[model samples]
Target: MGTASSQLDPEVTEKVSRDVNDLISKHRVVIFAKNICPYCHMAKNVFIEMNEAYHWVDLSKRPDGREMQYFLADLTGQSTVPRVFVNGKCIGGGQETQELYKKGILQNLLNQS
Candidate 1:
């Protein structure tokens, strides 16, 4: 997988990079994933259930999203869907996100943000 910065068009890439940066800068949690992905769905569901506010980027819809897919692959070395980020840090995929949730660390991060 390529980094989000690598897969985007000059314009879209700039936009997404800014978007991700702004999200990390303004919000506590951000999730980047495809709508059809089950793990992505689960991650969203968890956030919804907890009533936590998060920014979700649906890479399947946007032209720049393909770039994000590559970015995810490059960073994680896995082709898994639903790559998440917290506080400007890559937090891995759905299972890892869930593990953080299970460990009660997700809430802590959210709260801290």
Candidate 2:
């Protein structure tokens, strides 16, 4: 007797969670966001423009996406859309993301880890 968001398929959730964790763990950079978010688009564009490698989690249809969002909020202490994680460290939202790119710290972070 729970809402869809609270009743996600355990297998699917596990798979998605594993995929996300793997991307973050194996890769140097990761971005989590909804597809329609403008900031998400901007962040992606910046990465593309810089030719940086990154993984993206699109939560537009996944039932447990809200759960993932909550997890990000708890992990990063901010619930902003397009939450970016660099080498398992939360680098914050869109503007901060851009600033890091501008300062070239983002590239350095990727190079280090």
Candidate 3:
């Protein structure tokens, strides 16, 4: 699944693409992260400390995770772990997420939703 698949089924591609899109679009606050990433913990903690709820997908547990990572890069212009989204909009990685929280923008988004 990592390379060109001459015999790949179209249905499979469609389903995987839809799965990726759904994972990103279905949540108010989406954090695509790896379980062991420190930045991932930091991002999640920000939400926790603020008493905010967020949806998180640990890509390390998915078979199509790398594909989703690439998909995210194309869709959001960044591919790194902890791709944080607020209200279906890409807010970026750990540093960016924390920074937004510090500047009070993240709180506004949370309230808006």
- Count of backbone collisions within predicted model 2: 0
lDDT of 3 by residue, 43-103 (tens): 9999998988888889899887766676667667776898898887888899988999999
Ranking according to TM-score, highest score first: 3, 2, 1
The C-alpha stretches of model 1 lying farther than 4 A from their native spots are 1-16
Show the colliding residue pairs in model 1: 1-73, 1-74, 2-70, 2-71, 2-74, 3-71, 4-71, 7-67
Candidate 1 residue-wise lDDT, 1-113, digit = tens: 74545645677666655665676567667788899999998888778878877788888997767766665566567767787777777777888888889899888876665
Query: What TM-score does model 1 achieve against the real structure?
Result: 0.75
Superposition TM-score, candidate 2 onto the true structure: 0.78
- In model 3, the number of clashes is 0
Estimate every model's Cα lDDT from 0 to 1: 0.75, 0.77, 0.80
Question: Model 2's lDDT to the true fold?
Answer: 0.77
Prediction RMSDs, each to the true structure:
3.1, 4.0, 3.5
Candidate 2's residue-wise lDDT over 1-113, tens digit each? 74332355677656656766776787677889899899988888888988888888887766767877755665567766898888888788778889899998888877777
